[model samples]
Target chain A: MTTNPNTSTLDYAAVKPNDTRAYSVRNILSHVFALVVAGFFLYAAYGKIGPVNARQFAVQIGNYKILDAAYSNIPAIILPFIEVYAALALLFPKTRKAGAILMAGMLLFFICAVFYSAIHLGLSIDCGCTGKGGSKAGWGVIARNTGLLIATGLSVWLYQCGPCAPKTSVDS
Target chain B: MKHIFGVIVILIVSVITGVAAKAMWYDTWSPTKAAPPQKMAWVKQQTSDAIAKTGADRNQPGTSGDASEKVTDNDAEVSDSSGATDASLTADAAVSNDEPEFSGGFPVAKLDMVVDHLINGTAHFVDAREEYEFDDGHLKGAHLLPSSAIYENIENLMAVGVLPGPGKPIIVYCGGGSCEASHNVAKVMAEFDYQNIYIYVNGWEEVMAEPDRFAGQTE
Candidate 1:
């Protein structure tokens, strides 16, 4: 390829074609939020796989007293993999919205479960956020889940096919 | 519409994978599998594995050490499969801390004594593990009084005639291995002035060590 020698080459004020700044702020923030939410769910899912974890999670759910013993096992078996799928979805462009929605729904469910256990039942039990050891169910866990819910919402809407995608950045 | 489809796909795949994984570990986590209590099941498997490993190592000259012989010699008599060798309630527990300080001034149950008690049904056995664990496996005729649910289930225990009675021995056990559920249950029982409460500090793990004899005793 030959340059046009007659033309002025310098365009210092304009963003360089290869500049990192060319990555739109919306895209960058979305990527960051997507990664954070994905990492959180992935770690959360890690501790819930396998039979030992299933047993612990079953007991944790039983602590909630909302579900009978027979019913709790269903969630114990399926919930971890749900988190895993949602996390992987968040990492992919095609399914990011689905992941965000699923995670947001899960956070809402968790917030309610914790609130019911802590406030309604007045039970001081292990939150079982992670399989074995995690914080107790109370205001702190609710606050943390709320933060993650907001993060998931932001992750979905910030860029690249999201409603909040910048007018200029196509993520090409 | 696209997001809904994607969400459904993720959920469907997750549910399928989870069910398949459960089937893969059926022996460990199958809901329909009617198995003995966890204590019995774990102890039996561990015992058999240890026996098989020991059989292979027995030919090794030094490895066939006198540990078993020492145990037999240290105790007045080793418990047979029926646990009928000793009739005493405290058959010289192998634990170091049996004093008042260890179990908060509570009497501790010996393994042999526990077995004998279980067989004879002379004592009320309180399972201190979670309800789910108790459902999986527990001592035969043991009361399902999980320490965490004690307040809720104590009345039920009374209704079921599993309540601790005067002069009758109460043996409380948990999942062992630093498990304090038994102690916690005992604390509550103490408040009600329950007599002859014996805390099994080693609990399920100690029973698991001799699972061949214990397995038949569990549900």
Candidate 2:
């Protein structure tokens, strides 16, 4: 009996043979990861030039030097789309990889910005990563981003491993 | 190829869901609490209550001794003390765009009243509207310092001979009555420790309504 190779690669005996457990932990992890990512994107999109002026966000982006005053308004308008797209991408299997890659890249950029500001800028300027009350990004922000990146990376890797396939009678 | 494709699909789904969830958590579920003073529902209730109470008190016959008189008297005192305080409070109800002050208070002011002070040279007028709007038309004596760049270009107000120092009263406004950009700019001024930062809630449109009273004329 020919069986699915991807299932075996996924490390689930159901997809392979023998070992049987009532439930696999993959489903729970996927749900949790999806919830986390979706929530973040939705939140960021809300404040993006909706009622709140883009300049407020520009001031935030200014701290990182990723965007200057001239392009400040542009990012504010574009941010809402980025957030909505990122959220939808994470929910769908076909777009998950692209979403993961994009999310990871953004996180990495944020980490770099925070670290750069802390080391070179000496933290005098506001990091403006979050809301108006957002504290200057520092070592703490770097650690937080690193953890989130790892989680996203894991989700992407495990997803590639494939879903657990039901075992076949060939082994018996 | 099929297996690879399936795996890709699942991964993509996971990512899309995750990002969406993340956005929702922060923007919606996380900070569900609405800011005060900006909630239109509450403001609406207060408006009706004030108007109804005033109407009812006036409708009541003698021995009530003119209840409407008492209401106007109170309104007069508040206005005399705070210059159009009742009107400004009503104006606050007009716009839902309330920038949460760092100190947690919604700033409001009467544009017509502020402009009156500016024209009389009693107060300095600062146009907190965007550059484009200011260029289109703004009060004559009003100097343009877009709200977006209030923090960065604040010194320009001084350069324009508008905002001289900390003690001088400053009246700030953006576009028309509905815009909160001026309110945000006023907050920035307050953050800078400007004690007398007045917000022109009625804005330029309302101020321009009465031609003679306004000092800064715009086409």
Candidate closest to the true structure, highest lDDT: 1
* Residue lDDT tens for model 1, A1-172: 1223355343333434433344466667887888998898888788778865676576667666678745878998899999999989988867888988899999999999999977787665557787654366789999999999988888777764333312333222
**Comparing only chain A of model 1 with the true chain A, what is the TM-score?**
0.80
- Cα-based lDDT for every prediction: 0.66, 0.54
> What is the overall TM-score of model 2 with all chains considered together?
0.42
lDDT at position B121, candidate 2? 70
- lDDT tens digits, residues B1-219, model 2? 553464455456545554554455434521113223344344345445544554454445552333344444544222222222332333233332343121113345555456556556766778876565666777766777665455557656545544322234567776563445565566555543333456666676786676777633554
Tell me how many clashing residue pairs each candidate has: 2, 41
Q: B81 in model 2: Cα distance from truth in Å?
A: 32
Alpha-carbon RMSD to native, per candidate: 16.8, 17.1
Q: Clashing pairs in model 1?
A: B37-B137, B38-B137
Worst 10 residues of 2 chain B by lDDT: B76-85
